[model samples]
Target: MFSRIDRYRWSFQDSHLPEVTLFAGENVAFDQRAVRELRQMLEVQGTMNRWSSHAPEAFPEGAGLQKVVLTPDFHKAKGIPVGTVVQTRGFLLPQAVGNDVGCGMRLHTTSLTAEQVLGHQKALIPKLRRMFFEAGRNIPMNRLQREALLREGLLGLMDTTPRSLQEGLWQLFHDQDLTHEAEHTESLGSRRARNTLGLEDFLGQRDFTRDGQIGSLGGGNHFVEIQRVKNILHPGIAHAWGLRKDQVVVMVHSGSVSVGYTCASMIREHLSRLYPAGLVHPRNQLYPVPNAEVHEETVLQNWDALNAGCNFATANRLMLALMVRAVFQDLEMPTDFPLLYDATHNMIWEEDGTYIHRKGATPARGFEAMQNTPFRFTGEPVLVPGSMGTSSFVLAGLGLREALSSASHGAGRVLSRGQAMQGSTQDLDDLLRQHRVVTPVDFARTRPDVAREKLKELLQEAPDAYKNIQAIMETLQGAQIAQPVAELEPLITVKG
Candidate 1:
């Protein structure tokens, strides 16, 4: 157990962001699309209001079953909105878990520092370019290797990119790290979901699932960031989390892999038809389905499948880290090698027999159990990677917040990626160059105005786009949400 921090009550208060209401109100006119979604959402929300009025006991003693603190980065998502959290009695909504099951962020440090990286940056770019192509030819494995993969990109299909060889890489990985207990913890590379019928059936419906989806990043908000540890608030906590001031680290933020897309795509269709006609209960209608078993089985399978993809993504970063590490190794870079401080932005959890849906939030636990292990939390360090091109943070769970001990997934999203590409790349270029961040992957990297415009759009995702980290930590201070240790800012970013 840890010492309680501070108390801050959270009751349903006035809306902070404009053009949004907590519940249906009579203040402003509604857009057709907004009205449609609201009308439908309220049908379930209204029922919840009545049920809570009648059965307040459904909510825990003190929790009162608050939905979620939708921060500025809030947006529409699979079932629950992106920032939503569901603490329930006996149900799990698959949509709240989203398609990319177990999508999260992982941060690790290599024995490389800013100056050392500066020396080898150009030489490393070509190798960095090669890493993308390396996934295809050299990696082995066919279907079996693909099942356990969690990174959404590697499992199903890919856009312009090549299929991911991560599954093969995962199998071969153990051949080298025989001494390390890498496989004992959560498997980084294995395959399961693609082999299942549920996933298969789901993928059949959406051609996109079967299309070139392997080894690609999730569309919308998921991204990867290279950040510098701006500061450390608690050095003891920071050391426990393997962090140091001025340390440069790679933050890979991704989720669920392709199988999740298959599962969610299929399940969503079933629910869309089931609602308004089937046994749409007051509480279960918005995200309706048969029993929790069927869908839970679907998502659970997705969990296994996505984890495989994520494992491969981890492998991708591990190799990438090795590349960075190797370069720094030559330069005698002054930094730490990366360990697992994974921030899973989208995933689901089984807590006390209830489905704690973390739409775009990190699943946090305590550090006592995870300390000195790969997971430096009570379970493992929950990575709360800030927005792309911004700060990323390391969080350890206290696991006391009964509303299902969780925290905001990240600096969420103020605008979509499409919106970001609209702005000037110039501003983004200046900012990136000024910050020493590099965007060599894609998306108008050389064009300044194009990148700047894009940056401005993503500015919607800037620090201002999120709940003030201090405020969020303080508000949930005593609630056992997550404890902060160190802060990481962007240095070199790869946006896929």
Candidate 2:
């Protein structure tokens, strides 16, 4: 099913798996292990190409699938491939969206320069330690406020937030209407999601704390970094985004916290029971909820629950960014950290009247498609963050139709977390010293041993665990899906 196409791309076709389109296949070196796993998944019943006559009338549109695109950052994940974009006509697949519902990136530009932060590293590092590790007490919000943000996202919380916090937000976004900030965020940062699982089931019996995961950084490749725009590739787009060379920015990579996981688990369990016993595949547990087979009430309930998870994730990222902003305010730095854009990679989106499941791919709608957005002239700002200690990119979408209006999320993982920890000769202290990144683990005042162990786990997320960022960038530009606007280098990195 897998064969060579060209120097840069590869094509995969099978009787079961959806047609695969991969970019930079030669450069990144496709892992056959992951491809075999994908094939096992496709062989399952009710998938894109494996539906049987005896199966429920799931795909009324006859498979209801268009294509599956793998971005340049394409690589192996556990059951599904990361950097995958699946387009379906009338069916929605839960596995395609993966576990993280609203996993995404948020960029904020500040008036402060990289030099200022670096110079004050000693004073700033300890402050950051307290802010992230001290139970996030610095972020001004009560249980009710957290619930409002989760239910209604940034817009709902903006109104309910304390006056001081609201003022701080306004100070950051002086020009743009604070109420309309959701327009800049993907999916408007909120959806009409309801609590389908009921309050007790969703919260779990032992977990009584409200918004316990709101401002958390979360583990596994999630981080908040202080970066400087090293260079501007497209001057006009950079200017439009209010980004300048050498300017300081905060880039957050996180997701929906525990809310998304719970939602996914609930949906999966519901569908698993309904799946035909004969059609179930051992290697693949992915269940597709076809629009035709599902009752209208069930559909609405599922969407509401999914939207709630997505909204929670979107709000969680914002809250984390706000926490960073609070730190900057305390440090007497530029508190005017206006949001440049917020985009999620792990999601299922309805675009151009079709459902697209982007596991680790960013939506790259073209200028014409986004004519109503503030960046219609330049297309959406697709923020592609690099692995830790590497150069992240801000790119303008070219909106290539064949590519499903999507691009890579990051340098896709070359090594899993477990693989990264084995046969490692790199020194953690030297690596951080070279990158000049500050973390709470670095300043463990009381538990130095525990901090050191935490630091070792972080080392597993090193740039070496992922594909080359330069190659991924070149592939996107070569494919004409997205063009780089600016490159950002990290200075301070905070990981959970």
Candidate 3:
């Protein structure tokens, strides 16, 4: 039997539920359909309960979560609900951090104008394809990465696995200088039991080191978009970012893909074991294991792996950009190629060596801010990607607002991939056309199931599905921890 706690319009019937409370105020309201959808997306809801903020230990003395803000796009994800900003006293949840480890948008605007792209696209298609193909062929992995155990393979990707797979092994044999900063996983949120989310389990679902994942836009919401730098929200900021309206820019969004799934899968097992047979909760918030100190070594190992995984994620985009650049050169487009910003959505950081978990959120750093070393910075850029056929915003961090200096990761998904695939194909196609988006390949190009899965994610993430970003910006007016640099509009979308 489990101890029960009750609260108004909510209850901590589940132990885990007691750990969290949706701060839905009078303005916050959800229809039954939305509620049902959210509950379903929260895959583990049946095992957890809900409570208000005033409830017991949910809001500990010092949690990064000073406030919980949900937009119209709010939905459920691994453990924490998407759009949920959590500030824990001292911990991080790998699931909340998300599967696409270090998955964030990187935007680059060039000096070219629109006439050049529209005129040369016919000549540009082959070049773009070749770029992706070649990048898919060669992706670099460091020594530590060689050993991390997370790589990928597509059925097409798998058959063509490059000899690079053995390069890591060869390096070790040759005694080369390929060392990496290991990932540390121990933290206030880590459970005492072994983390099932280790790379040992999920590494090979796809291999970037090989030909499997490189140049490949993996399944689900990830995409590479060709956008027009249509607007500069803040002139001063835009100048700093080197962006100009009407210029062409490219945006790439992807994460650890299958590798991340395995890491989180392993951790889920740990959470399951942490809960005793008789113990039950309305919810299943990540239960950090006891004897956390002892797990420090293991935690560091996991953290290092996660960090390197982040490096992999970065390399993923870099390789793709190299292709984009090659495409531009092939078409002789005048657009320049420069990495504006690189950020990660799923991550845990040390604030002065303390733990900070950021899930479905990005850092909203300002020009000057002090965040414990390795952290103190004038500000960091925040990449906010919108729906594939919509607009993406670029902002610089201010500092801390509610808790951690943070902002929503994207238009938080409102539906699950399964739910998103429900609309008619024609309707989705029409929507894209209306948005002026030209997908590189049509729906037929994707596996029926994979296409549906992506559609589901797209539906949940459609521009209409998110809160008006401009309104969000208005809400944060003066809270300019992140000054708007540019407003990017999508032209072409490549989703795999």
**Tens-place lDDT digits, model 1, residues 354-466:** 55566666656665544555554335465666554556667667764544556666654443444545655556556655654433333434465565444655554443343
Error of 1 at 178 (Å): 7.3
Off by over 4 Å in 1: 1-8, 13-79, 125-138, 148-195, 198-215, 270-285, 290-338, 367-379, 414-426, 440-480
Candidate numbers sorted by lDDT from highest down: 2, 3, 1
lDDT of 3 by residue, 41-143 (tens): 3433222222213232432333332223333235555455655444433334455566666665666666776666767765565455444533423444432
RMSD of 3: 9.0
* Per-prediction TM-score to the true structure, in the order listed: 0.67, 0.90, 0.68
User: If ranked by TM-score, best first, what sequence of candidates would result?
Assistant: 2, 3, 1
Model 1: which ten-residue window has the lowest total lDDT? 21-30
lDDT of 3: 0.51
Using TM-score as the measure, the top candidate is 2
- RMSD, every candidate, angstroms: 8.6, 3.3, 9.0
In model 2, the worst 10-residue window by lDDT is 199-208
Compared with the true structure, what per-residue lDDT tens digits does model 2 show for residues 148-216? 555676766675654554433334433345655687897678776555353343333332243456677
